[model samples]
Target chain A: MGLTRTSLTAEIGRGANYTDKHDCVVALAGNPNVGKSTVFNALTGMHQHTGNWSGKTVGTAFGRYTYDERTYSVVDLPGTYSLLTHSKEEDAAKDFLVNETPHLTVVVSDAACLERNLNLVLQILEVTPKVLLCVNLIDEAKKRHIKIDIGKLKKHLGIPVIAITARSKKDIERLKEEITRATDNPSESAYTVQYDDEIEKAITTLREGGVGTRFEALRLLDGTPEAGGDSVPSGAADAVAALQIARTAAELSDEIAKALVKTAEFIAKEVVFVEKATDMRREKIDRVLTGRIFAYPVMLLLLLLIFWITIVGANYPSSFLSNLFSSFEMPICRFLQRLGVPQFFTEMLVFGMYRVLYWVVSVMLPPMAIFFPLFTLLEDVGYLPRIAYNLDRCFHKCSTCGKQALTMCMGFGCNAAGVVGCRIIDSPRERLIAILTNNFVPCNGRFPLLIAMTSMFFISADTAASSFWGAAFLAAIIIFSVMITLFVSSLLSKTLLRGVPSSFTLELPPYRRPQILSVLVRSLLDRTIFVLGRAVAVAAPAGIVIWLLANINVGDASLFAHLTDLLNPLGKIMGMDGVILLAFILGFPANETVIPIMMMGYMAEGTIKGYESLSALKTLLEANGWTWVTALTVVLFSLMHWPCSTTLWTIKKESGSLKWTAVAFLLPTVIGAITCILVNFVFGFTL
Target chain B: MISLSYTPMCALSPGECGTVSDITLGGAMRRRLQDIGLIPGTSVRCVGVSPLGDPRAYEIRGAVIALRNDDAEAVHITR
Candidate 1:
């Protein structure tokens, strides 16, 4: 395919133009959340768009760059570790590189940990010769005192090495210059280490079809199907059996194992070098973080501390903001009163709709603002890897890799992101297991629901002491969600995705003093705005519906009250009232607003004071009817119940199977109801 | 069985374990396995199977590696 000038500029539109004989296909690959998006944006500017790779839910981003009148189409393959076909991202990366044969493959590795990064680079080098290693994140690496010898690395690999800070334009420009100069199909260089003879013999025989021996050898080593595209198809098992006639299958497998070990040693010696000797600082920290005895406790303590900070710190700001917003409402209400506006319309518009919106922003924003930065702080400090390491055993018990824990943690932030994050699990079965169990961990949306329940039913918000105790009690409920996650993961592993867990070489990234100022700014703006945007979009219409439900009365009761009464029987069985059930049903758009809407319903006629503390909240709930049993049931249900509609939509988008999305919706709800019913039966509420 | 934990049992699928076998894997396939310490003579063990019945998980030293059964079929193991 000669590079004909298709006037692709017109096709691709104003952002990029195509010139003749570009003859270069550069594949952008990296680890997830490593500023891959930032790099892509900088390189392609406004010309980038996302598309599916034929059938997969995995989105492939492709962009065009023009330099000196030549156009290069850059395919930003999904961020993946190694191109093993276990996860969707890996499957996408392997398919693109093997089938598409990108003329220039740019493997972006985090410069902070070069050894682990080399694993992906080495895998690509084995497959193709036209690869330019882009050691991205030079800035991050420098912060951790990592100094890479780019020139030496280039000489060692016999390929162009570009040191780039992906977010920086100058670094990207330098990379583009190297890409422009690199060969499309360079002479293939072998980077394979010696394997044992039996494995070698099997590999040699597999390659009898004249498909390269290295491809067969590595496929055998990694055990992924799409490693060589269609070099071998599954339906040809008979042919494979016929080919292996000379050697027993067991013999062939043993040979590959030897090759794996020998290759690891050879590569480790050549590519990896530690500038400094092993030190006590990192080791001491790891002992505490990854210790068999201390690890889980430390993890719990850290979680509790984060939640405590979020609950306590959020209150003052939330109240201050609410008071500010409520003060404005009073003035507005008086003006409307002066204008001779009717009481009902004024209450519906200002109190019903506005108060709910204000509660959502006030109650939810502070926690998100405080918590995201703290979470990002841990991530920035590189403590997340240690978390993966600490939790590896637990993940292994679930027949998945330890990295799946990271995805599970992401689920706490957002389930959809967690589902996408499962790319870290290289095994498809393991990845599926992670995705299925991810929703068991409650996201931030569910937190407000849990906290509101705790405050209303279990602890009073009238006093400061009660608020503090109530927040602690709610923190326990969040921890309970994690416990449930562990239990469900075990069940799924043994029953559905049964297997010995895949061993992963965990790199414990050394901790550094967090970039607090930068992390707070980026996470606050990026994550907070991103979440609030979703809430506003979905919750605005939901608020209007809620207003309508409370206002439009049929005979003696309004639509909301009527529905709540209808659901009362089932709700009472689970230690909650019909109103609580109806609120959850309507609050499917955003769980954070469930409490405010409930309050709107409770104080239908009278002007209600939004409780300033947890004790006062409990006094109000007690007046309405609440016991500790009700609080416990509500918290449990909130944690285990069906995810919001947005999360369900994301599940559909990520799984690409409406069947799985349906399963995702039903499975959690069933478990939630069963658990709550059992708890209520055993504990017998006194109300 | 002195059982040195670091030197994992050589119990991979017959095709994957070789006695110093000569092989070359180019492109993405090679690095995918290489990244996870699936280098030559790593003494990988095919300990279990995934439910989909394709990708198999292996134990290498103290770590575990999961790959597809098709990928496992490619590896030539030596006794």
Candidate 2:
């Protein structure tokens, strides 16, 4: 395996094209985990971080590159297996290709694994012919001792083929030149798959019945109405009714699908010859990791380890950041005072608003920063698909596609991303189920709350020996929460969201090493900031209101204490104080602010309750009339509680129904309350 | 008695047949139905229904495709 010839970019000096209002549009299509992003960055001279995994490009990412004075807008379509839209990314790519109408579509194939990638290539060719075959990752392909006949592949594809290691820009210029040339002379040829006799017969029938176009003919054969499921015109429905009179529609759809798959398989066998099957080392390990017997326990243990690591890693940084940010308050207060702002306004803006903002950033950022990169590492290593595969059984039992596990995995980072990720689950019933249950997997905002409670209430000073132990404890709590979520979802499926699960074929993407630094930076900025920003935006105002309540005296005590007293009995029954309940209510907008508001409530209204040790924290709570039962209740309630407002808004948007959103909120709250009551009853602790 | 060459899939008048000619799928509607193996060339039959009659279930690909009557109207086929 030899490295390809390297070429240097001799910048052709020319004035930038100012008159061209619309730049040349190029679409970047590829298999997941190939270095398409690296190529995008290299070509564009932009530093959009790259990760070693699929699914990161949840939405089509667009960037610009200037070549020979002309700027080309490159859209990075999500990596897909086939253009069949088995998942959301595939659907997005197919739709973008058909509807967006980009000037040039660059389909990036992994040189090492061209056969699997070619499945998509052939499908895309059927849709449009203005395509460029970018044989990317030539370096990886070379290491495998495989050589591709570039000219042959190009001839086979009937399109321009460029061999590239996208990380290096050696042949990028040539590739760009080819793209420019291809755009100038757009190809109009389309590929067709040879169908089985039955499919040919059905296609002929459908076509003669009036489905004239190839793509339309194929879809009609598959049974998807040309319009979406929700918008079937009356005339079309009438036609389908008439068609059904001759042959069973469902059987015809299945036959066409089988034909398409058989055709693809035939093409694969003809074009690809495996030199030697994939190194059996990974396969042997996958046997255990994704095995029949050990898979479930292994998945549980692995998930537990992830949770444990996240919690332990997050604690020190959370506290350190909290203390450091809190220390800045005095200086900020003095500076604001020096500016001669009114006293109350100064307090509101600085201690109230600024303090909450600081709390949100300091507390939330560190955990997400640590958690996302580690998760990204697992993703890059290609464990997410296995997780999905293993969990598919559970999804199937619930009458949903197994791919919903991917969305559930995304939920751990942020529910908004998870909601967006739901586009991957092809079945509407399953997708909606995934969407509604997404909040059950706590997002970055809620992680701190869970971690803080676990650290404060569960861990004793003697137990707080190492980060590993803390992480283990956190993992246990998370595992418990997930189990509860799964239980609730199961119940929902059986009762409210009941139906037989739809069938779907899920493709397991290969493992790759996640690009560490890029994942960290992007997730921290994109996920952490987005969540924290929402939290801070809500926290600032909520903080002022809390501050005012603490300061403003009511009949006997401060307004804060008065309200807490009024709600204390019910809170006590739930094993929480009025202050804690208030914190949860206030934190509904964003969980990042809960700790800060709780601290502020404690600080201004009562004694200095912050502790340097876990035991000391426990002692403080115990002194405040808490018990082991109380601690347990708080953790359980937090696990099953309402999602943050952003998640709720996403639910409303995705479901397009206020009724479902309300159900999403109330269902969780009800579960939380019931669990708390049941725990209290079992423990025999009366508030 | 045999009647017309085609009948609408959405017509509450059941026990009809049609050949699917074309399909239109995009937006939320596409997302909702694509997961159920609703590709073209599948044989379909109108099955029995619930009381409300909004979602008319059609058996396709050895499974059920439950779509609202309005959605069923989009399929243009011929007997």
Candidate 3:
């Protein structure tokens, strides 16, 4: 497929909006886990946002930076191993290089493992001559006793090469100087990989016949020429057709690939040196971590450990935040009373909007603050890929991408983020399967409800016993959700999606010592704060709507009661009351508010006012006829129901189609209803 | 002297080493395999198997890559 000029122009426009304001546009490219993002973040300072995982940076991220008084716009391309592959990331990085034609392209290679990365560097060199090779992670290389002769490699490749550790600013200044120098001098790269004679002849024929360049001709020969460039000349098309015939007859494409690899290996041998082959600590660690017998147990233990930490650690801070917010609420309420604001408006603002906001912040923040850092730390230490590795077979059995496991992990934090994480899956069919089923995993928003309900309804009254049983029950629910996710994914793949799981190369990146400070900062800023901000933005408006529904009377009862009464039959079929059902509907904006909404509805209040403690809330719930069945059904529905409004919006945005968005919304709702109905039926017969 | 016998990569026992002789897959899959240093003549070692025992890790060019059995079967290797 070819990219149209309009789309290419649009991509460039989307990539760097400040193209007009910058002196140069530099594209940062590298293999995954090479700290290419660190270089981008350091050079661009706070102007750039970096993704922590492979293929996370699906789109080009542009940031502005000043070097030697000249402002430059830098685009951080998605990390890819080689441009030759047809993965979404490779297509993105290649399209940007071939179509956008940025002034300077920086290929950041990890110094510790330069050979494998050099394959991409070589491919990129074939595209743009004005390239700067930034050999990052020099410090790590030193730790491994690996040395790279930067000058020799630069000489061999005929491009400027700079050595720097991206985390520190020590070499950033020199990197800036080198980038400026390369941009100013802009030399055509003399680097070219020699292919087989037949392939060379075919390339020459296509080049002379008015093909754009050898790179384009080679891409054409590979039978995967990029889409959307200026239309090929008629003569060039004929030459390409002839070349294809010759290539098929000679099997030249594979030959060309082989030759490229050979060249990369040759160049690497010439320039890279290992002083002493250090012990392969990563391999030794992997043996135990990924060993067949230990992998599953280890994975389970680590997951439990992370959740255990989040649960135990978040408790104190959550209550503290609750107290802090509640204290502020009283003062704000008193101040509103003193100002002589209308009671209705004051109630709506403080009791409705402010209370929901307070609950959401107090409930969502602490766990996210604790959970995201731990997640990021796991990612930084290269443990995530092992999880994916361990889970690959299970996903493969379900006929979906193994990367779905990673996306599901993201779902634990937020389903909206999980939907965005689906970008990592290259196949549209499997990606849709992942997205449609991701809501089966209860996000952090629903955790507060699940934990509370589990503790109140299922666990013993003893604090320690309750906490232990709560964690165990939560784990069981999570495992159930994952099983349901797999089952639904398999069903979708076999039915609507209908495709075999495509294979992908999962790179087990070398484990590195995670920087505690950076992990905390990134997880907090990129994930915790970002997700909280979106939740809060949507929650405030939802608060007003809930208040209106409760206060506005419809005949005898309030509108909220009337709505709940209408939902009563359906809710009863699913083992929940009308109030609980209405709360779920109103809780569409954010799941964190579901319990609070239920509380407000049960209390016959016009707004979500407050609940002093869990036991007091439990008393009110029991007074409103909440049973063990109701709690169980609520937990099950929470685990399986339609995603929140923010997640639905994200689904729409990420899928870019209303049809799939509708499917994503309806799929889980249907499943949740079915599951709840089944549970309620079984329990009614037994009880 | 070289043995001409070939086996699918997945057939190799853990810790068994081989040279990638040919990739029987085509198009994007073949290209992806090559892109990750699975080109012909590259030495590969079966490092370990995942818990469920389908996707196995292989060390190639000093990097570990996990491939499912189905995809691994597409790669022909000579021990």
**Best candidate, TM-score-wise?**
3
Q: Write the per-residue lDDT of candidate 2 for residues A566-586, one digit (tens) a residue.
A: 878877767678877877777
- Whole-structure CA lDDT of model 3: 0.82
Report lDDT (CA) for all predictions. 0.62, 0.63, 0.82
- Which CAPRI category fits model 2? incorrect
Interface RMSD of 3: 1.5
Error of 1 at A559 (Å): 1.7
Off by over 4 Å in 3: A1-16, A47-53, A226-230, A275-279, A328-341, A463-466, B1-4
Q: What is the per-residue lDDT of model 1 for residues A1-687, given as tens digits with 9 covering 90 to 100?
A: 000011122236234433234445677776544455456656777323111111112356566778766788776777665654455667767777777777788777766555555656666776777788887777756654567777767766777888888656788888788888874335355355445654455456556644453654456433444544455634334445653575554344434443543443544456445464333465567556655577677777787788778777987898899889988998888888899999887776676667667767787688888877777777767677666655665566556666677777767766655776565565667777777778888777777667676656667546889977875786677667666777877777787557766534443444555656656665666566666666666766666678778778899988877888899999888877887787778878777766655665566632224655666666667777877787787778787778787677666765678887777787778898888889888897344
TM-score of chain A of each: 0.75, 0.83, 0.93
TM-score, chain A, candidate 1: 0.75
* lDDT of each residue in A200-283, candidate 3, tens digit only: 887788778787667777777776655774367676777667767755722666777788888889998998898865337877
- Looking at chain B only, the TM-scores across the models are 0.58, 0.64, 0.89
* Models sorted by DockQ, best on top: 3, 1, 2
**What DockQ does candidate 1 have relative to the true complex?**
0.10
- Per DockQ, the best of the predicted structures is 3
Model 3 pairs in collision: A2-A227, A2-A228, A3-A227, A3-A228, A4-A228, A129-A189
lDDT of 1: 0.62
Greater-DockQ candidate between 2 and 3: 3
